[model samples]
Target: MRTNQSSQEEVEKTLQSITGIERASPNPFFLTRVEARLAARRSAPGVTTPWAFRPVWVAASLGLALMLNVSAVMYAREALTQDDQEQETVSLSAEWGFDATVMDW
Candidate 1:
């Protein structure tokens, strides 16, 4: 029982010694430097150039993409239409065994 009591007291003393907290502090001028850096960033130009990020440039790029897509679709549709017409002419010629060039002969 005496040994247990001594051990308990030792544990309590160890706990008490570890319970004291130290205040934390930043280095001097840390906040001032942080603020200065933030101000410099705010005043500095962005990482990307102004022309690349501008709304006008974005709109123009989108417009160009849209125009390209529209033109491609129109061209594809026209090509498909021409293909269908050619196929129809070929089928009609095959069924009738008549060629327009035969009239020229």
Candidate 2:
């Protein structure tokens, strides 16, 4: 009984300590300044590079690099295969004991 009464008193004290403000002030001329800045930025023309203003240049550059890498890999693989084929090998047939016949056909 005593604990419940003490808790209720504490809750009432906490509720009384909270404050709520109903009125707020607004920023004057905020919209006007935002519109003026937007207009000024739009009127400026020489602020950026031609390629930097587009997304296609980056994609094209990536595509070109990918093609070059693919081409280099293909060429390297072809050269390796050609070199491996160029190293010719020979085979021989065994007769009975220690005689072998070299067959080049």
RMSD per model, one decimal: 8.6, 8.4
Where is model 2 more than 4 Å wrong at Cα? 1-39, 42-53, 89-105
Each candidate's TM vs. the true structure? 0.52, 0.42
Give the alpha carbon lDDT tens digit for every residue of 1-105 in model 2.
Answer: 999999999999888776554566668988889999999899997777798447888888888999999999999999998876544221222223322334444
* Worst 10-residue lDDT window, candidate 1: 96-105
Measured by lDDT, the strongest candidate is 1
Instruction: Give lDDT: candidate 2, residue 92.
Output: 21
Best by TM-score: 1
Ten contiguous residues minimizing lDDT sum, candidate 2 = 88-97
lDDT by candidate, in order shown: 0.90, 0.75
